[model samples]
Target: MSEENNIPSNAPVFQIQRMYLKDLSLEQPNAPQILLEQTQPQVDINLALSAEPVAEGVFEVCVTGTVTTKVGERTLFLIEAKQAGIFEIRNVPQEQVEGILGIVCPQMIYPYLRAIVSDVCTRAGFPPVLLTEVNFQAMFEAQQAQREAAASPTLN
Candidate 1:
């Protein structure tokens, strides 16, 4: 029974310490004139995820989203938002750390990022830009494959 109690201490642990909006920017470079255009503006959205070690057994993961709406050659509005979370991951295997950081951590942080982007857009007097759900596992796998390909020697 005592040995069983000790097992939990050595077991893997993953926890979210806190989540926050790390940065947000809304830019309407060509606001008044562009907003007057009758044609629908084209919307472009880009997202990026990153993770870094904050302390021993603690990591900060972030999801950044940029939404740019354009009316012809002029810009309507641009929203850039970064949402981050601090996670505590302890006793996890080294091999699995990369997957957890690249996939799971981003999965946890992305919804908040989406909300921030949408809210900022609506508050800026533009229609809300809803970010589509992401498949972090697929993204992680593709990144891993890309890294592997880059590391391999090319024979011409």
Candidate 2:
């Protein structure tokens, strides 16, 4: 137990650092008539995740999604969230860096994005939307496993 106390105070730290919108897209299938309709709309949401390195020790992860709701094709509401974060990682292994950016940082930054999406949707004349939680850790593991499988050649 005594050996465990020797861990340094400043170890490899994982932090959100900062989050922003790298890009965003919004489309209304029936904008003109939808603007004139009055009804409670049902919504459908889709989420997408992507990560890319900008520079050494710096990376950007984008979590984007679309919300489409229609009052019989009148397009009651539609919005998209393109949330991204710039993470500063140091002292971690190179192989682990992708997981850090793709999984960890995005998990930390998602709530803010969710709130933003909910608020934007509500303020845009639609009901508030609550996005479901994402499992980034599991996603990371899956990604790593896929990469490993791809790298290994099969003897046919």
Candidate 3:
């Protein structure tokens, strides 16, 4: 008789342990004057993602967003927020780890980061700055391409 278990012991494992707001900062340098401006303030947003191993099979992934609103030469307000998640990943192929970290993990955590940024802006007496949906797969591909280009030697 052949005996085989339903589940494999080394099957790929991926799980989210926790998600939370890692850090947030709001700065209104020219508050009173900038607030009085009749002209619409220009909004600029920057986002960054990072992942690091925290334990044997645990990783911490973080997404940071920075929003800066400007009225002409004056700064209206700036908001920087970092959202992080603790994920457990194991038994996966080494080749797939990079994609899982750069694309999959960020996709799971980005929505919460967006909501937090918008909520903070609204509570701070400013219109909500809704973050647009991101294509992490495309981003990861672009980054990989960039790294490859950088690594390859140019012919003289």
| Stretches > 4 Å off in candidate 3 | 1-6
Model 3 local distance difference test score: 0.93
lDDT of 3 by residue, 25-135 (tens): 999999787787799999999999999999998999999999999998888999999999999999998779889999999999999999999999999999899999999
Give lDDT per model, in order. Answer: 0.90, 0.76, 0.93
The residue pairs that clash in candidate 2, if any, are: none
What local lDDT score does residue 116 receive in model 1, on the 0 to 100 scale? 87
Top TM-score prediction, candidate number: 3
- Model 2: what TM-score? 0.73
| RMSD (CA, Å), each prediction | 2.0, 4.9, 2.6
In model 1, the clashing pairs are none
Model 1, span 1-156: residue lDDT tens = 148566567678899999999999999997687778889989999988889999999999999999888888788998889999999999999879999999999999998998888888888887789999999999999999999999999999
What's the ranking of the predictions by lDDT, best on top? 3, 1, 2
The Cα RMSD in angstroms, rounded to one decimal, for candidate 2 relative to the true structure is: 4.9
lDDT of 2 by residue, 62-137 (tens): 8886788878756666788888887777668877887777777778778877888888877776668888888988
The candidate maximizing lDDT is 3
Ten consecutive residues with minimal summed lDDT in candidate 1? 1-10
TM-score of every model?
0.93, 0.73, 0.94
* Candidate 1 stretches greater than 4 Å from native: 1-7
